[model samples]
Target: MTKLRLRQLVIAAPGPEVADDLRKVFQLGKPFHDKAVAEFGLKNSVFSIGDQFIEVVWPVKDDAPLHRFLERNGGAGGYMVIFETDDIDAARTRLDGAGIRRVWNIDLDDIAASHIHPADVGAAIISIDETRPWGSWRWGGPKWKDEAVEGELSGAILESPDPNGLASRWAAALGIPATTHPDVTRIALDDDQTLIFQKGEKTMLEGFCVSLQSAMKALERADDLGLKSQGDTVWVGGVRFVLNND
Candidate 1:
C-alpha cells in the first residue's frame, strides 16, 4: 500500500471576520495567496504550520455548500483533511473497489487531487493529492518551503459515537492499520502523524495537534491577542487549536 501522510487541515470560516480572528489568534503570517478557488466558491487564507498548512476558507457565494456546512456544524468547523499520497491512482482504485465516491477531481499544472465524500468516510471531506515530481506542493505557494517555520504536524482527532468503527473505516480506506484501545483508536501515518478517534455524540472532525517552538510562548501570544485559552488548547473560529512543545 502507498503512504498517505497528513499534509493540511482545512477550516470553513463562516465569514472573513472569523478568518481574520483565527489569524490573530494563531499569530499567523500573511496568507499564501488571495485568489479564489472557483470550483468551491471559496476565498481562503493559508497559514504555514511547519510543512503542513492550516487553511481557512470563506464561501464567496450564498449558494455555496460551505455555508450549509457551517450551519450544520453550528457556525464553523473542520472542513477538510488533505493527505499527500505517493500514488494517487492506486488510491483511487482502492477507493473505487470499496465503493467510495470521489466528489471532485482537481487537476492542476503541478498537482492532481481527488476529494472523497465525507459520507463515504463517515467524517470530514478527504483529499488525496499527488504533487508533480513527488513532494512539492504548489497550493502552498512558491515561498512556503523557505518561509514556513519549523514545526511538526502531529495529528488530528475525529470524534464519534463509535470510535473504533470509524477509526477502522478510515484506516482501511487509507490503507493503514487501526490500533484500537478501550478509550480511543489510532491510525499512525507517515511523518509521525496519527489520526485519533475519540468518543463523542456525533461523528465528525474534532481537532488537530501541532508542535511549536514553545507552548507557553504560544499561549502567551494568544493571551496577548485577547484570545481565550484553556490550558494548552484555544478555540478560534470554532475549532480547537492545541499547542505543544513536543
Candidate 2:
C-alpha cells in the first residue's frame, strides 16, 4: 500500500456569506479558481496553506448536495477531508474489498481522484487523489504558489459517537493503524497529517488544527475579525482552529 497524505480540507458553507467570513478569519490567500467549479452547481474558493489547501464549497442551487449536507448536519461546518495517495487504484481496490462505496471519481490530465461515501467513513466525506509530483495541484489554480499563506494543516478532528469504531474503520480504509488514547484515537497520515477521532453525539468534521509559521499574525487577523482566541486556538465559524508557532 502506498502512503496517503492529507491534501485538502473541504468546508461546506451554508452560503457565500459564511465562506467569506471564514476566509477573513484565517487570513487565507487569494481565492482559487472559484469560477472553474461553477458548472458543478457549486460556488467555491480555495486557499493555499503551505503546499496544502483549504477549500470552501457553497451550494449555488437548491439541489446541490452541499445543501442537503448542511441540513442533515444541522448546520454549516467542516465537510470533507481529501488525501493524496501514491497509488489510488490500489486504494480503491482495498476500499472496495471492505465494501466501502465510492460516490465519485475524477480523472484528468493532471490528477486522479475519487470520493468515498460518508456512510463508509462515518461522518465527513473522504476523497483519495493522486497528483503528479505530489503538492502541485491543478485544481488550486495557476497562482497557487503565490497564493500560499503562512501555515500548514496539522490534522483534523472527526467527532463521532463511536470514536474507536470510526477510527478503526478509517484506519482500515487507509491501510493504516489507529493509535488509541483514553479520550481520542489517531490515524496518522503521510506528511505529518493526522485524523483524530473525538467522542461526540453527532458524527462530524469538527475542526482543523494548523501549525502557523507566525502565530502572532494569525491571532491578529482573528482578532481583527472579532473572533475569539484563547492561547493558540480560536473558534471561527463554529470550528476550533488552532494556530501553533511551535
Candidate 3:
C-alpha cells in the first residue's frame, strides 16, 4: 500500500488579521497566495514556511464549512495537514475500506484532492493533493504573493487522549515506523519530517502552540514591539505560543 506524506499545515483563525500576526511574530515572511475554492465557499491565504505551507482559511459565507469548524474548535490552531499522494482515488478507496469518510474533494482542472477528517484519523485532519500541480501552478493570490523556500519541517506537536494508540494507527496508515518517546510517540516521514503525538488527559481539541528555531529571537523582537509574554510563552500581536511540555 502506498503511504500518504505530510504536505501542508492548517491554521484556522476568526479573521484575516491573523495572517499579519503570524507574519510579524514568527517572521514567517509574506502570504503565498489566495485560494478561492468556490465549492467549499473558502477564500484563504497560503503562507510559505520553508517547503511546507501554513494555510489561513476564513469563510466567505456564514454557511461555509470553515465557519462550522471555528464554532466547534474555537479560534486559532493547527486544523489539518495535507498529504501528497500519487493516486487520490486509490488512496480514497483504501481509506474507505478502513471505514474512513472523505470530508472534501477539490478538483483543479487535471488534478483532484480530498481530506479525511481528524475524528476518523485519530489526530489532525489529513488532505491528499497531487504533485503534478506543484510543477506548474503558483499558490495563493496576487496581493499576498510569495514562494515556498526549502527547509526542514522539524516536527509536529499533537495532543491526544491516547497518543500510543494514535501512533500505532498512524504507523499502519502512513506505512512508517513509530517510536515511543518518554512523553510522546514520534513518526519520522520520508522527507525528514517528524510527527509527534503526546497523550493529554483531555479529548477536547485545544489549539496548538508552535515553537520555531528562532522563537526566542522572535519573542525578543515581539517584546520590543509591545508583545507580551505569558510566562515563557509569548503573545505577539495575536500569534500565541506555549512551550511544549512534552
Candidate 4:
C-alpha cells in the first residue's frame, strides 16, 4: 500500500511577530530554527505539534518566494503542505508521469525531499519527504523526540474558485483520485488526514484545522493574546484556524 501522511504545514507571514502570535495562541513550546532556510532569504521557526510540525517563514529579502506569496495573499497565509511518504520511488515515478514540475528536490542518505511547483498544484507547494529509518524526521531537529505536544494537525482547507477542478488537480499531482460532492471536494490521505477544497474567490491554501487536547485553553489564550477569536475559529497570521477540541 502507498504510505503517506501529512507531516507538516508551512505558513508564510508578513513578519516574524506572527510567529509569536502562533506560539502564544497555540500554547506551543520553543521552536526549532532551521538555518537552511536562510539560503532562500527567509527565516523560519518550526514548532512541533506531537509528531507533526507547523512552520512559519518570513522573507528577509524582497526577492524571496515567501515575499511574493505575502504580497499576493495580502499578509500571512498557508505556504506549503508537506507529506511523509515511505515510498519515495513510487511517488517520483507517479509525479513524473503526471508531468508535475519539481522546483526543488534533494536526495540524501537520511531523507529525500521534493518541492512541487505551486503553479502545477494550484493550492500550495506540495512537498513529499521520505525519512530513512521510518518515523525519524530529519527536519524536526535533535532532542525533539522527547517533546510531547497536545495538539495534532488534522487537515487543511484549500480555497478555490472551482473546488472540484482544484481537487482533481491536486489528486492528479498526489497520484490519487478526488471525491467530489455538492459542497466540497475531498482528497483523503493517510492517518485520517484530508485536503478539503471549498468554493472561494481564488485558489490558495487558506487555513487548516488542529485537534487540540486543551482546546478551550487555546481559544482563551488566543483572546488573551489579543488575536481575533470567533466561535470555534481563531485568526492568526491572517489565516483561520478551526479548532477541534478533543
TM-score of each: 0.93, 0.93, 0.76, 0.96
Candidate 3 on 1-246: residue-level lDDT in tens? 554556566677777776676677666766754555656677666766555666776667778877766776556556677667667777767667777778877777655777777777664677777665552333433333245433334456666788888777666555466899787678886555677777776432233345466556666766776767655577532233553322
Off by over 4 Å in 3: 1-4, 107-110, 133-146, 203-215, 224-246
lDDT of 1 by residue, 1-246 (tens): 676799999888877776687666655667786474756788887778777898888888878889888888987888889999978889889888988888888788788999898888886999999888677887788787766766767888899988888887787678888988777889999878889899999788888787877667767767887777889897777677787885
Error of 4 at 131 (Å): 0.9
Query: Which run of 10 residues does model 1 get worst, by summed lDDT?
Result: 27-36
Candidate 2 local lDDT, residue 151:
74
Q: What TM value does model 4 have?
A: 0.96
Cα error, candidate 1, residue 113 (Å): 0.8
Model 4 clash count equals 0
Best first by lDDT, ranked? 4, 2, 1, 3
lDDT tens digits, residues 1-246, model 2? 587888888888777665576677766778885686676679888889888898888888778777788788776688888888878889889889999999989888778888899888787888889898766687788999898986789899988899999898888778899999888899988778888999999888888888877677777877887878888887665677877784
- Evaluated with lDDT, which candidate comes out highest? 4
lDDT of 4 at 15: 74
Point out where model 2 deviates above 4 Å. none
Question: Model 3 Cα RMSD, Å?
Answer: 4.3
Clashes of 3: 4
Q: Of models 1 and 2, which has the larger lDDT? A: 2
Instruction: Give residue 188's error in model 2 in angstroms.
Output: 1.0
Model 2 residue 12 distance off true place after TM-score fit, in angstroms: 0.5
Q: What Cα-based lDDT does every candidate model obtain?
A: 0.81, 0.82, 0.62, 0.86
